[model samples]
Target: MSGFARSVVVGGSGAVGGMFAELLREAGSRTLVVDLVPPRERRDAFLCGDVTAPGPELAAALRDADLVLLAVHEEVALEAVAPVTRLLRRGALLADTLSVRTAMAAELAARAPGVQHVGLNPMFAPAAGMTGRPVAAVVTRDGPGVAALLRLVENGGGRPVRLSAEEHDRTVAATQALTHAAILSFGLALARLGVDAGTLKETAPPPHQVLLALLARVLGGSPEVYGDIQRSNPRAASARRALAEALGSFAEAAGDGPDPAEGLDGVFEELRRFMGPELTASQDHCQELFRTEHRTDHEGEKDR
Candidate 1:
């Protein structure tokens, strides 16, 4: 396909779906948003209905849609397979924006055979826009539709990374699962130590301050979304276990335990090797980030 002429977003009420709808519209597609709840805005492009429960409106939307984005929650997305597949016209592309890919990919392959499908996971919030953001694209069945979808991401300033369903889930287990676990654990530790936000701001070192800010950002988001990320990925348990083991080692090193400093040094060296050429660049980036954060904080104080 040259480009999608008409696109329908099945769960366009939610943040991710809404973002996908916006991006498709910006990419020059005539977008229609279908959701159970009334659209918050952009009424011109929205239809209120449950996708799983078929209706004429949804049927009409899917009949002419060149691209259909399943942008609902993971569980809902899975349930929508039968209904969506039934409604999707031949040659129309079906793509999903689920955070976890393995299960959805398998379901789509098994239930919607011969359908050109793609799995998408946007690594950042929609409000942040796609500019410089990473997007994981798992092409279950490659075709012109898949190419157009990838091109759409590129047009909207997203970096599209192609990965298998398994690869995508495994990577997210480390990147999303482990990272969120560590940040949430940090927040919990602060609470256990009776550290208040004001006290943290007043006394924490720069690194600690940076962590506190990250924890705050994580907590500010939907708890259900984070919970789903932790629960849905099969490898998440291993990542959590690894985090616990590392924390235990750190505690042992700090306590009256045998000297594990050599072991720690070895681990540090391994990480440095993994980072390799990126280490210096990463450090520079962090320094700049810190400077910008400090300036923003000082400006906020002046406003106060």
Candidate 2:
């Protein structure tokens, strides 16, 4: 099949859901949005209803759809799968935008064994657009519908990376869960120290400024989304524990060791070894970012 002829987004009012809905529409799919509330952009076909207690209208829509994408919370998605999949015709695709996929995969297997499904997680914010960004695709049951969805992502300039459900969860634990925890921990320390934002902005070095940028990103978004990333993934706790242990090691090295300088050097060396060849490339990339930031700041001063 070229692509899905009819697509339905269960929570098309939300960011992730809305993104998919727009993409599907642009691909010439007869897109229908079914949600508790209306989406920001009005669509020709829309159904206002809960997927958990799907009404006859909603059931008819689901049954007719070639693809049904769930963009709701983990609990809601899990709860709706049985009912939603029951309505979906065999060979129809069941997909989700959930960060954690292991549970969703299991749910689909148990609830709808014959349904062709995939678990997708957009690595970046929906507002950023899919262009040149990584979009994880966990094909639970591969079929024509799954291929169609992957093509849609690619056509929209997204990099659809194929991964298993468990693999996706493990990798994201490091990329999302651990990374967010580190940035948030830094923000928490700044707050605990009662550091004035203006003062920090004035005197903070490039690394501090970089961290502040990350802090801004985390703080600006919905806490519920970030919390789901941390809580839903089984591997997240292990990743966070690793972060805690590393911090303790650094503290012990500097404060408890006989020779602080030597201890710090050893820790740094170990880290560098762990990072391997990619560390140099990362350092160079970071330096380029710092240079760009410096140029922007200098230009602002010139304007002033």
Candidate 3:
């Protein structure tokens, strides 16, 4: 069959969905945007009808579609998908753009038996488009949809990195979910202290500057988006527990005990671990990303 044979994208008015529609069109896919909100006419075709509280209109729009991508919330994803399952082409690609992947992937596979399904975890901002970005396609063992999905990636200038559904969510739990939580916590701490971040720039170190830049990106990003990333991932709770345990260990190592007057034992313990024989800490890898002796001729361009 031709790629995405009559693929219909649900929810194309919002940021992620809109970006998906734009990129898919650029990639030569004949995509039709479908949603509940009165569909604005797309440069391509669109169908506006509600699927949750199903009606004939929504069911009719889904008929003969070879691919259906749900670019909405986890709570609404499966429900929006269920009503149109039987109407979808026998082997249509059923995928979602939800951050909480494992459960959704499993639930989707169970509901629409024999359907080609996967979970997409995009690692960059929707505004980033697809150029030079890494899109993790968490593939299901049963699906024959990977090829067409990879084609979609290539069309949008992305490198499609294949990962199992489990592996994808595990890595994201740490890399994205936890990382966003820490950055957001840092912002909250700054706000509590009445610290205007701009005041720190003159005396800021490079690491802190990078952090400030990251906070700006996160702050502008979806609150509910990161909320699910941090809260919904199962691994996060265990990770938080481990961090607290490590902190307690540090207190024991220091002479401080539970009292404030004593010195920190945690610092010494970490130093010892880093200097140990089994796994030596290497600065080379660290240096390449954040610090190195380098010179570049490029300077900030002035506004025209």
CA lDDT of each prediction against the hidden true structure? 0.85, 0.88, 0.69
Clashing residue pairs found in predicted model 3: 254-265
Candidate number achieving the greatest TM-score relative to the actual structure: 2
Instruction: List the candidates' TM-scores in order.
Output: 0.90, 0.91, 0.77
Expressed as tens digits, the lDDT of each residue in 167-231 for candidate 3 is 87777777886677678766777789987777866656555665777899898877876776768
**Which prediction has the highest lDDT against the true structure?**
2
Q: Which stretches of candidate 3 lie over 4 Å from their true place?
A: 38-41, 141-143, 189-198, 246-304
Off by over 4 Å in 1: 254-256, 261-263, 295-304
Ranking by lDDT: 2, 1, 3
lDDT of 2 by residue, 24-99 (tens): 9888899999888898779637889999989899889899989999999889999999899888887899999998
Judged by whole-model lDDT over C-alpha atoms, candidate 2 comes out at 0.88
Which has the higher TM-score value, candidate number 1 or candidate number 2? Answer: 2
- In model 2, the Cα lDDT at residue 252 comes to 80
* Model 3 TM-score, all chains together: 0.77
Candidate 1: residue 280 Cα off by (Å): 2.0
Q: Which ten residues in a row have the lowest lDDT in candidate 2?
A: 295-304
- How far is 207's C-alpha from truth in model 2 (Å)? 0.7
